[model samples]
Target: MSRPRVQFMRRPGRLMLSAVAAFAVVQLAGCGKQAAPDAETTATLIQPVARLDLKVAKAAPGSRSGEEIYQSVCVSCHGTGVLGAPKTGDAAAWAPRIAQGFDTLTQNAINGIRGMPPRGGGADLTDIEVQRAVAHLANTAGGNFTEPPVGQ
Candidate 1:
């Protein structure tokens, strides 16, 4: 008796069917019981990468103190003496300007000097506020300048 010979891939359709069946078996196997993520976990995974809070309280005009004004505006350049600006608390750098007197310094602050914007770049600042900031900055560098009283 002779045995029969069988070839597996003799038909292209059989090969395609075998591949589809194998894929379905794999897909079914992957459907095993798996714990679903909780709401909080899913939310965290899809949450925004960054967030900003811009709700800052602001003081009324002429009410903010000299220190407050410096910290808010003048500090940008004066704090580091950037672009020839005299750094805060540097007596030598402030000596020439201080010698020019308080009025001169106040004027310079109110009307923009080299590298320094008018009112220290604080457009909302009143003249008195500018005066106060100037006195504060000048006094910090060994000058005895007087700042206008608050709310003036």
Candidate 2:
């Protein structure tokens, strides 16, 4: 019985082509960091969409909900307790302040406490708005406080 012969051939041209292709792929698979935006581009992107003059705006009376006041202004400091401001939802941190009584708290909020600015930095916030925000913060920190109604 005769065995069939199998061909074993090497193509130098094909092997060289494969080697070049593999090298090109490895070279293209480089770990390069992306370049950051230029200063002008960064400035453009960081520019404020609208600049609000809080001072002028403060003169105009307006009613804002407690949650809105908190979100727009109080969150800046209370959210993170910046400069010793009582952090929201922190019962321990708020306990002493809450013990001061709701009226005192609202007064402090209106007059500006040790670290908290008046009206929680929202000069535009009305006295009633500040009271509501104070109630919201105090209530969240375990005090059973009632937020004042709007237009009060």
Candidate 3:
């Protein structure tokens, strides 16, 4: 007498079906409704981390003031006295340069002295603008220098 043989191929198909059903149940379980974000919470999530405020001084058309020029251009080096450049408001560091007089300082700024590039690295700055920036820098460090009039 021959015994009945169990079907091994049908067992694999049933196992695959079971696995697919389990996956679908798990995915459906996570599809439940969630609370919508409130206006303040949404805004906070998307808000900028930092902001910048540029306050430009009022000046004549196409002309920047001594302070304006200094803030924009000369502040990089002179503000911190990088590479022997005199820092703003440092009387001792500026004493020798101030002793050299306004004309000499303006010339150095225009021609580039030592580590400073021509026009304090602002090639777009005009000669008068350079003079104005020089005056602003020198004055901050206890020197009495007049800023050249704009439009010169």
Candidate 4:
């Protein structure tokens, strides 16, 4: 009679669980001289990291169209007017900024405004692409500016 040997990793679910446990232990262990909370702490600690990973993964790609860049990057802050950003298509909000003139607005967008990061947080966007996106947002908000063609 022969006995069967079971390898731990031969079971994918078990391997995954083991890996997660190991990760939780390593994460908790890094804290100095603190008592670790049991199983529930692992899930709580992992959730924020997972959310941040998804945010980084969703970062905008380079050389996209104005609308695409707006949808991917600008929408996060601009669409909802987060952090004092003017909401897209808000005529009243865009009024003062439009009065600043197109060049100044695009320059601010390119250089980072009070709450906005440079290039509307799409660090990979080309200068012209950013300009186009600025125009797109401005137009949607009732401005009549025209975006220059790419490369000039």
Best by TM-score: 1
Measured against the true structure, the TM-scores of the candidates, in listed sequence, are 0.70, 0.59, 0.61, 0.57
Worst window of 10 by summed lDDT in candidate 2? 54-63
lDDT of 1 by residue, 74-143 (tens): 9999889899999999999999999999999999999999888888789999999999899999999999
Error of 1 at 101 (Å): 0.8
Which parts of model 4 are misplaced by more than 4 Å? 1-62, 150-152
Ranking by lDDT: 1, 3, 4, 2
Find the candidate with the highest lDDT and give its number: 1
Better of 1 and 4 by lDDT: 1
Evaluate all candidate structures by whole-model CA lDDT and list the values in order: 0.91, 0.83, 0.87, 0.84
TM-score of 1: 0.70
Off by over 4 Å in 3: 1-62
Better of 2 and 3 by TM-score: 3
Tens digit of per-residue lDDT, candidate 3, span 58-152: 55543998898888888999888799888899999899999999999999999999999999998788888888988888998898988888767
Clashes of 2: 0
Q: Give the Å shift of residue 65 in candidate 3.
A: 0.6
**Ranking 1 against 3 by lDDT, winner:** 1
